[model samples]
Target chain A: MGDISTEQLAEECLAIVTENAGKKKIKAGDLQKAMAAKYGDQVDRKDVKAAIKELIDSGKCVYGYFGGSSIELPHVEGSAND
Target chain B: MADDLKIPLLEELEKGPWPSFVSDIKSVADRKPMAADLLRQLEKSYEDKRGYWKHGGLVGVMGYGGGVIGRYSALPEDFPGVSHFHTVRVNQPSGWFYTTDALREIVDIWDEHGSGLFNMHGSTGDMVLLGTRTEELEPTFRALTEKGWDLGGSGSDMRTPSCCVGPARCQNACYDTMDMTYQLTQNYQDELHRPMFNYKFKMKMSGCPNDCTAAIARSDMAVIGIWKDDIKVNQEEFAKYLDDGFNVQEFVVEKCPTRCITVEGKEINIDNSNCVKCMHCINRMPKALAVGDDKGFAINIGAKAPIVEGALFGSVIVPFMKIEDGDYEELYDFIDRMWEFWDEHGTARERIGEFIERVSLATFLEGIEMEPSPKMVKAPRDNPYIFYEEYFAEEDEGEGEGEE
Candidate 1:
C-alpha cells in the first residue's frame, strides 16, 4: 500500500472520488488521510496533496461546493454544487 | 443619472435625513447600463415585495472550487443588463492598504470589463466587484492576476482573512497583524480557495484587544495582539496628566476592569498581576502608559453570526503564541488540528462554534488536544439552571397522570 508513484496515488484518488461521486462528500483532507492510512510513511501527505492537484488539473476530478467544497464527478449536482 | 427614467421609490429613498445608497447608486449609474436595470429591478421589488435576483448554477474559473458568486436576474427578459450579474470577490491587500496606482489599475479594468460599481470592501474584506457578465469572468480574473492579484474566498471555503491596521498606523499594536494575515492567505491558498470545512471559516486579526476589526464577533478564528509583562509607565507624563487637570480618579482609576489601579497623591501604582489588559487605562492616558515589551497574540476560536445556533464571541484557545517573522508552522498546525476535528465531527452547515456548543467545550478541547485553560471562558456560569431538563424529568414522572 506504500511507496506508490504520484501518478499511481492520483489514480487511487480518482477511484475514491469516482466511487463516492454521489454517495458521500469527498473532501481533499479526507482523501489525503485515507491514502496516508492505506499507504505507509513512505507515502507522504505531500504526495497525496500533489496527487489531488494532479487529478484536478487533469480534469479527472472537479471541485464542487456540496455543503462543503468536495471532489466529485464534473457534473454531479450535489447540494448547491457551485 | 438617467435623464428620462422615472423612479418614484428610489427618489423617496433619497429623501431621508441621511446620505442614501440610492443617490450613490445613481451617481455611478450613468457609468454602466446595468445600474439602470438594477434600479428598475429594485423598484419593482419594492412594489411587489419580492426579490428579482437568483443564484445561478456552477460558475467559476477553471480548476478553482470557490470565489465566484453566481447571480442571475429572474426577470432576465426585462433586465438583460443584469441577466448574468455575477460578483467577483478579489482578495484585498493586507490591512486593506493600496497605493493610488494599484487602486487605479483595478478600477480601470472594471471600467472596461464589467460594472463600474465596486465595493471598496465587503464584510469578508474582499474588494467586491459587484456586477459582471459570465463571459467577462476569465478576462477580468486574468487581468487582475496579471497584475499579481488573487481572488478571495466564498461559499464553504475559508473566506478571506482580514486584519486591522497594525504597526503601520496604530500605537497600541502588539503584533504584526498584516504579516500574519498575508502569510495565512498565502500558506492556506488551498483552504481559502477550496471548501474543506463543514461551513465557512473566517480568520480575523486585530492588533489589540480594542478589537478595531471586531474579530471576536465576526471570525471563526481570531488572533488578537496582547502583552505578558507590565504596561510601561511614564511617571513624569503621569504627573503631567494630573497637573493638567485630567480626571484620573473619576475615569482611569475607577474604570480599570479589575480594579488593579491605585492612585495615591501623585503616584500611580497598578496591580500588574491582575491587569486584564482591556486597554481602558492606556486609552485614557496614552502618553503616560504603553503596552509591555513582551508581546504576542491570543488565538481565539469559534465566532460567527446566528446560524444553526445563537451568535458567539470568540473564546480563548491559545492565550499566548509568539509569532516570529517568516515562520508560521505552530499557528497553522494548531488551526488545522481544530479544523480537522470540525471537518469530521460537524454537521452540514454547522459552524465550529455551534459544534463546540453541541459537543461541549471540554470535548472540543480534548479533540484538538489542547489543555483546557482557565482563560478560555469569559466567566464562570453564574446562572447554571437546567430548566428544560428538569421540566422534562417532571413530565416523565407524571407520564401516567394524563395530559394536562
Candidate 2:
C-alpha cells in the first residue's frame, strides 16, 4: 500500500461527509473505516485527520468535537458572510 | 459716468480661513495688464451676476489643436483680454512628478505666449493657462509638443489615470501604481481625446489598503491594491502596543469584526482561523501589522456616476488575481471582455454595470470563462446554503427502484 497525498485525502473526506449528509453525527471511527474500505492499507489515521482539517479550512466541511469527534457536510452558503 | 464706471471692491471681513484666490490673482494682475483686466471683469461678473465675456473657440499653443484652450470674443476691444484669455492645459508628465527645470520650462512658455497668470493644476491634472487667443491654440500646442510635452483629455475620451505615490513614497504599496497609470494613459491616448462613448471614462489607481487618491469614489474604473494571505502580526510590536497603554480590550480584540484576535497577558494571539484579512488592524497599527506575502489585487466593476441608473457602489468582481511585471494582461482581458459584452447589449447611454445588472452576473461570468464564487450573488441578502438537490433526486430514484 502507498501513502495517500493530501489532495486525495481531501477528496475522500469530501466524499464521505457528502455521502453521509443529514446522518446523525459522523464520527472519526466512521471516517477511518470509510478510508480503510477505499484505500485498504494505504490510508492511515494521521492522513484522515489532516484531510479533515483541510476540508474545514476550505469551508467544504463543518465539524464539532464533543469528546468523540463528529463531522458533517457543510452547506456552501450563497453569500460570503454566510 | 456712473453707468460706465466700475466699482472698486472692498475686502470682506470673513472670507473664510483659507488664503484668498483674489489676492493671488491680484499679484499676477500687477505684472500683466491683460490679466489685470481679466481679473477685474471676473470680479465685476461676480458682483453683477453677469458674465463679461462669452466662451468658445479652437485654442492651442502654436501648431496643435490642443494644449491652450482659447476663449475668444468678437468684441475683443470691449473685453481686451478676451482675444488672448485662453486656458492652456500644459501636459503634465506621467506620475505628475516634476524637476525644477521642467517647471521652469512650462512656466516660461506660458508667460511668453499668453498670460503670466496660471492655475497650477487644471481639472484634468494639466497646467491650465487661463487666457490665450483662438489662433494661438495651434502654435501653443505645437511649441509644447516640440518641447516634448502634449495635450491631455478634453472631450469624451479616456481621462489620464492618476495614482498615489506607490513604492516610492508609501510602505504599504504592493505594486508600481504610478507607472501602471502612466502606461495606460500613454497606451490609450486616442481614447482619451475622442468622444466615442456615451459619456467620459475615468481611470484611477491606488497603491495599497490606504487609497490616497480616493479612487473608490472618484473614478469610473478603480484599481485597488490587496494581498491574498494570512495577516502578518508582529508579536513583539503588538506586545509593545499593549505595554504602551494601548487599549487591547477596546481597540484590538473588541474592535475586530471577525473576533479573530485574543490577548492573553502581554502576548497577543490571532486565530488565523477567523481572520478575514480586511486590513482593519493594519490600518490601526501600521508599524505592527503587515500583509501576507501573497500579493495580488481585487478587481471591482461598475463604479461610475449615476447618470442612467441610480448611484451604484462598485461591486467586487475578481476577488483576487496576481499582478506581475506591471503588465496586467488579465486586467486588460477582463476589460476587453466587459467592453464587448456591454457594447453588444447596452443601449446608447447605458453603462457597463447597468448593462450587467440588466442581463446577469452569471451570463457575464460565462462570457469571461470564470466560475462564480460563493461570494457572487444577485443581491446582498441571497441565501448561501446549498443542499444537493440533484443528489437527492438520484437517491429518490434508487428508493423507487427498491419499492419495485
Error of 1 at B291 (Å): 0.9
Task: Choose the strongest candidate by TM-score.
Answer: 1
True contact recovery of candidate 2: 0.00
- Kindly state the fnat score of candidate 1: 0.37
Candidate 1 chain B: worst 10 consecutive residues by lDDT? B379-388
What digit string (tens of lDDT, one per residue) describes model 1 on residues B299-399? 77888888667888788777677776768898889988998888768877889888898999999999999866445654112111011222443553453
Question: Which whole-number lDDT from 0 to 100 does residue B329 have in model 1?
Answer: 92
Give the runs in model 1 whose Cα sits over 4 Å from its true position.
Answer: A1-51, A75-82, B378-404
Question: DockQ winner among the candidates?
Answer: 1
What is the C-alpha lDDT profile of model 2 across B42-118, one tens digit per residue? 65666887775544432222212223343544445665754456576665665568899887877787777667677
Q: lDDT by residue for model 2 over A18-71, one digit each (tens)?
A: 787756556545665688788888976557756765666576765432222245
Each candidate's chain B TM-score?
Answer: 0.91, 0.78
Q: DockQ score for model 2, please? A: 0.01
What TM-score does chain B of candidate 2 reach? 0.78
DockQ, each predicted model: 0.27, 0.01
